[model samples]
Target: MSESKPGFRPAMTWLHSWAGLVLGLLLMTIWWTGTLSVFDKEIDRWMQPETRIAAPEQRISADAIVERVLTERPDGTLSSLLIYLPEERVPFYEVHAEFENAESYRGRLHPGTGEELGDEVSLAASGFLYPMHYRLHSGAVGYIAVALATFMMMVLLVTGVVIHRKIFTDFFTFRANRKSRRSTLDLHNVTGTIFLPFHFLICLSGFAIFAGWYASIPLSFVQLADPENRAVELFYAADNDAYYSREAAGEPAEMLAMAPMVAQAETIWRDRYGVEAKADRIDVTHYGDANAVVEVRRHFPSNRTEAHRDSINFDGATGAVLTNFEASPLRKTRTWLEGFHQVRFDHWPIRWLYLVAGLSGCVLIGTGFLFWAASRRRKEAAQPFKVRLVDTIAVGSITGLVLATGAFLVVNRVLPLDAAALGIERAGLEVRCFFYVWLLTFVHAAIRKQRAWMEQCRAIAVLAVSAVALNWLTTGDHLLAAIGKDLWPIVGVDLSLLSTALIAALAAGRLRSKMRQVEEAAVATHRRDMGSPSGAAGTVANRAE
Candidate 1:
């Protein structure tokens, strides 16, 4: 409500604090989910344990999987089909298809046998945390909101750097044992300063990936010059010509085998690029139509910079190469930026680094909220309504979300496989359980006030430990068993859950101790004031005299 000082730095500082405070919670949710999405596939394997097949020495037949999918579809009415080949990390072949009425089906098959893998009603990675990270599961509206948050994040990062007088010095400074407010501020500064470049580029690249939706000027101009519906078509166009459709040839024709087409694609990649690239995914469009096309996308090697760009399309009938989508210089730059942001090159070490950077951002935003609340606590004592609201929201958003996620994982294990007997889908029940727990945390926070942080932290600790316990109870796959079986993904997820519980427990203990210290300090101040010569009791006696 007050004007900032008449200086650039002061203006930036004001912007940094207020802007961050307004959107910091949403940013934290996005970052937290995005961090989890870095390991979405691993989590998928952990959740859908039936898909945990051992990789075979010889690759399975793609033709057999395609034939099986076609036979399994309802009356052979296929709109489009995608087959994700099995690899060492993901050892199950996956087939996904769309129907005429926008309905879709997905199934996993054993790499060695082409038999169905899991009947468990699982959303796997795509249905759970991955979608939340990108779109918050709210479709178009959520996408716009996430993009706006990313833009504001960029603004906050830039303004934070501009306002900090000793950015470089702060990067090397942290005083954890100092007073609460000072320690919180130092952490905020250190995290923001140390990971500034990574944070900046990740935000910028995320915005650039969806630039047409948010920054519409360039797209608007292109729309004016293009056909009326061409703008919409170009907006949804894929890298290849797979989306194009043609009328049925009026005669049903058996499709060509996919194994030869896959082998040919690999040969082409080796011959043209001089690299032994494997086709990770194969997409077939208009499967029975004469104009059907097959698109084979190469899996980028970890050493390659251009990861998502290499793909070859072929005529489904003749198995002849149709087109190889090669990136231009600008497109290549964009691809590299996205690849870096998404970390799809399959490097675990780099992925872990991304997770660390993302968590640091979370800490930075969290401490910023704490610093704001703590700095205003004394001044706003008389009318502490706003401070209390922020404190409640801070606890609800940060620790509450963690608690809710743990509940979700636990519910995933606890819910019956046929949850439909209760007229609720198992996957939907898991999601509902998450929201219910999260909403309850806000209610608890309002009721408990300042104690909510400790309460929620303790709740999170309990829920996290319970999640791991439930996994063991339901699957009989404890960390030790998972490790013995060489199921690193499950082992990692179980260990991570236990580690989270430990951290939450420690945090709860720290908060309890701090609360005691604060109570003692307040009592000491009160006793000293009451015993003073001109204190409340002394003033009353003097007045009576």
Candidate 2:
């Protein structure tokens, strides 16, 4: 923290720049996807039109749904089943069950008719964006990479604060009209300063969410002491002893009516906890067995303190209450940290706020890249290979990601509904299109050099517009129609696409204007050189002398 130390600020500055630049693109991708995940359910609703069923007037019977699932699934296949009751955001009954051999099934059910809803088009907001944000869908390696990036982000944030002695003053110091490098630096400083606490917490909580994965040394010691995995059990221990014991009888019996069980759980919750508890989900284990257990998880109001801890279990066959479990204080603290990072209990306003904060983080990283490139422009001209390479990567990563995401949305809407029948998995195709387009953008950037930025911006604008159009052509749900129908998810997505188009278009225009200014300046400099004696006459005079 001592500014007087020789080379302290400069060393810290170098660390900040290199650290941010090295992983900036990956961080941007993670941040962008994480931002979208704030409203992932809404995106899922927009993507999977089959899931946009209307809420039922009367609650659907869970027993009937269970029967339906049993008939559809193979005999003795279901090991466990989870039923997510319909809510305002997700209006279709969702069933997720695990099979005997580790296979899983997920499908939606019509609320009133109790019929399975077939998805012709596979939309992947939840499957793609959410996983990509956290895991990159690459399993363990991706998890390690993301964790390392998150740790680096924390380092950059701390080093950034240490170097910026005028952090408070810089919060109000944005000079937009200055030279590009200076302006970019100012913006980076301002954003980093203003949202420092948020950026720190987001990074910390993100790492903390997977703390067990990263903090394996201590966990290994704990595991060594408790070979029975009691440490793990204690970490996730339930409030009641019955949570761990449910002896299934050899004889099978039909589950008791779910309506009564649900009513009983609600009554118990309200009477005991003084909170109106509506069942958010029902999870049944040992289904059809004599000692089958049904757990009804209640939807509590969005209180960060609660940490989503409200559930009552019942005897699936007898309709008798079993156990109610609440989180321990330690577990609740972990849940609260996770809730802060994931925003699971947040409403629309707070969700949007999280999105904006996430976007600002992206901006901070982006401006850092720009500042590094712009500052080195003149010095690197003699051997500009490294600078050009970084420039291409920066362009491809920042704008290419936007372009690729827009193309992904467009592909989702443009592909035929029965794409799987045509030998192409619809969801996989969308993901492939995204990465392919992104990879091509990198090639395009390398070829086009500085023009790549403006070109990709325009490309992104076109893609955004096409996505909106394709959504309308495929779904017959234009923005105006969606608004009229009060389908805010669709409306929000459409408006957001349009806004993205406008922003990209405007950026392209400004970049073009800047390119023109650079050309004019270069032409003037050439003319001045030729008109002066320094052109050919000065060379001839020097030779004669």
Instruction: Compute each candidate's TM-score over C-alphas.
Output: 0.89, 0.89
Error of 2 at 101 (Å): 9.4
Query: Could you give candidate 1's per-residue lDDT for residues 1-545 as a string of tens digits?
Result: 22344577878888888888888678878888888877787778777768655676665698888667767775657768898887656788888988766778788888877888867576755577878877888988889889889989999988888877787767788999987788889999999999999999999888766665664545667677874757556665633333334455555556788888888877877786676667889888887667778888864545555555667777777777778766667766777777777776667788779889988988988898888777666556555578678777788778988888888887777777778546878887888778899889888888887788898999888988887888888888888888887888888788888888999999999988877766665556557787563344323212211
Q: Between which residue pairs do clashes occur in model 2?
A: none
The clash count of every prediction, one per candidate, is 0, 0
The sequence of per-residue lDDT tens digits that candidate 2 reaches over residues 30-126 is: 8888888888888887778776666777756887887787788756466678999876677778899887677877788988877888863555678
* Span of ten consecutive residues with least summed lDDT in model 1: 536-545
Tell me the alpha-carbon RMSD of every candidate: 5.3, 5.1
The per-residue C-alpha lDDT of model 2 at residue 231 equals 61
The candidate scoring highest on lDDT is 2
